[model samples]
Target: MKSLSVKLFCLLLVVLLTTPAVAEIVVEPEDITWTTDAGIVTFQIRFHNPDPTAWADEVSCTLYAQDFGVFLPNQNEIGTYDVPPIPPDSFFDVFMEIPFDQLPPPPEVHHPWDPMKVQPYCTPDDHWDGNVDLIWAGPGGAGTIDSHLGTLLVCPTYGASEIHVVTNCVINMTYTITGVCAGFTVQLVNEDYTAAPSPLAANWSGYIRVTADATVPIGTVCCFTVNFTCGGSTIPLILCAEACDCGPISNEDLDWGRVKSLYK
Candidate 1:
């Protein structure tokens, strides 16, 4: 009887000691903060790792933009990290660089001519810059609610529109015009607004077919003057400029401040 009681006590102790305890891993400053120089935005994410034994061999972090609902509106897979183990209750910083000329710019970037004096409704204005929100996902507590990060632009560079693009091959042009550029719709039409077969379209702010009659060259800006016909009458829209085959990815926005940036 004594031996049996001892064994039972030992088993209970092992169970109590070995059972995993869940400590919520908290990432601080829940939103990503950015700064711009040139045209790239280097996002600095600071986190507090509560787990001593928990470390990551590789972590995949992604950035996305959303509209209204939490569902992914538009997402750009930023990249991954090979973060080693983080000692328990430790703090660390991780970063990703987004070039102004490459990835579409954040809508909040201010433009000189914007009448509202509010930042461009959509930035980098290379793509639909309006109504898009940012999201961050990763491993090592990445997907968990606590692991995600929200982003807000602190200081952003503007005027990405003047950059040039050079493409060697023939291209397709797509167009869509919203109140401030929304949705992806493509239609090809002649100068007189007639659809032309085998028309090339550009995929931007939603794909649309360009006016076929305009003989736009490779480096020339193919400006689209469009009208959005939606829950009402025709809404006029303008795409100032677009270029193809610009250059490699660059993060013009990577300047850090005295404070830390975090994911909320």
Candidate 2:
């Protein structure tokens, strides 16, 4: 199962470059990573109005990558957003996102693999830079000025996220798909009891494994979730794995409770 946090991400592409002659466009929190790993990356775009007596209204903004370089994908637009009204001498905030799956890889890799996903896993130092523009028509007036879009740090990466079963001594443990798990597969592994024989051992150990098919783009993080029921009530087992792989429940993320107590 995927983390509940990943399922909640929403938002993606397009760029609009409008200059403000009198009014100005300002963006905050620069140098953001491509973040396709986290699904969608949303950043704030703030519009600035210099005039003290007038207001900046009807604001529109756009942001995108300028280039991903050789061997990687080249996308012009990343995402666009509309800015709210900015009072004179103040700033108004809006948002733009890093689109996923919308990116097209280079032609050489255009089969079932290339262009399969938006993540550009070409060079380890892939820096996707681009232009940004936020325009607004106000009583003061709008003008033009070329500005830098938020830097898209598309660092080339490889690896798969996996979920492992570390629990032991659970009889007939099973799982059910409780959410939409499109474009992925899950595996159930049963571990035989070594201390005791098969028929004699009532409870054993096992885990559900998830691996990314080669078709899955490199550095691409899959999305999905599942519920494991081990019959009756019991304490959640500890899970652990490499970065991005899911398995053991982290101490910070799990809520512990006493399922039962042993007495003399």
Candidate 3:
């Protein structure tokens, strides 16, 4: 019995010594950025794996937002990607674009509707989250690591605007600001006027004209502002005249001949 026990212990020690160690896998967000334009939101995210001996593959990401239903159509919320194998201690980037126009309009307000009261037109600004999962097939066996991309502010989309002018006339202009929080003031400032709606709130859209003397030299740049303020948070936006209408000698229309002259 003593000889048999010693042989069993030796066998167990040999098996343990020959087993390979599993590589530790880790996933983290390296960078995240977003831009909203023309009722569309585009997001770019970079993910990193810090494990020096593990390569990641079969990567996928899912985005989540509480207000996604309000701004995106049914089944338009999920996105997937097949990432190329990331060598140990490396990173990869992915991009996603969401269209807000496909979403259904806000439900109608009920009960004692008051025209004197302002109403929110869209979902309020909120935090957006995502999950990233990938596989590490090395050493011991196939393993997976799930990571959270953290939260980011999903600001409302602000459409593009341009100042329209014919020779020397400032055309009345309109801009739409969506997805701001409730009770926020939308202020516009430019060479023209610093004006806000009488009662500004989220999902506000209106028009402002150049208050300055409209008669300026052709090709002058006219910039306008849209400021959204809720509590202590404020979002400021600027729109240039060239966006709407081109001016004589418009900065964008400069000839190649003129560009060459500057280099000389």
RMSD of each: 16.6, 23.6, 17.1
Question: Candidate 3's residue-wise lDDT over 1-264, tens digit each?
Answer: 999999999999999988643433344333545545666666665656666876655444554322211111133343555555566787777787766443222211111111112113212222232233334344323444332221111111212221211111122223344433332223333323235443443443333232222333323344434433444433333332321112123222332111111100
True-vs-predicted CA distance for residue 92, candidate 1, Å: 1.7
Highest TM-score, which number?
1
In model 1, which regions exceed 4 Å deviation? 18-22, 28-31, 50-60, 65-72, 108-264
lDDT of 3: 0.35
Per-residue CA lDDT of model 2 for 1-264, tens digit only, reads 355545443211111223333444443333222333344545455556666755566545455443221111224565655566667688765556655344432111011111212223232212222333333333434532223221111112222222222323336544443332333454444443122222222343333344443344434433333333445632222111111212233443222321110100
Model 1 CA lDDT for position 144: 26
Model 1 global lDDT (CA atoms, 0 to 1): 0.35
Candidate 3, residue 157: Cα displacement in angstroms equals: 25
| Alpha carbon deviation, residue 37, candidate 2 (Å) | 5.4
| Candidate 3: Cα lDDT at 78 | 32
Name model 3 segments beyond 4 Å from true: 1-32, 68-76, 102-264
TM-score of 3: 0.31
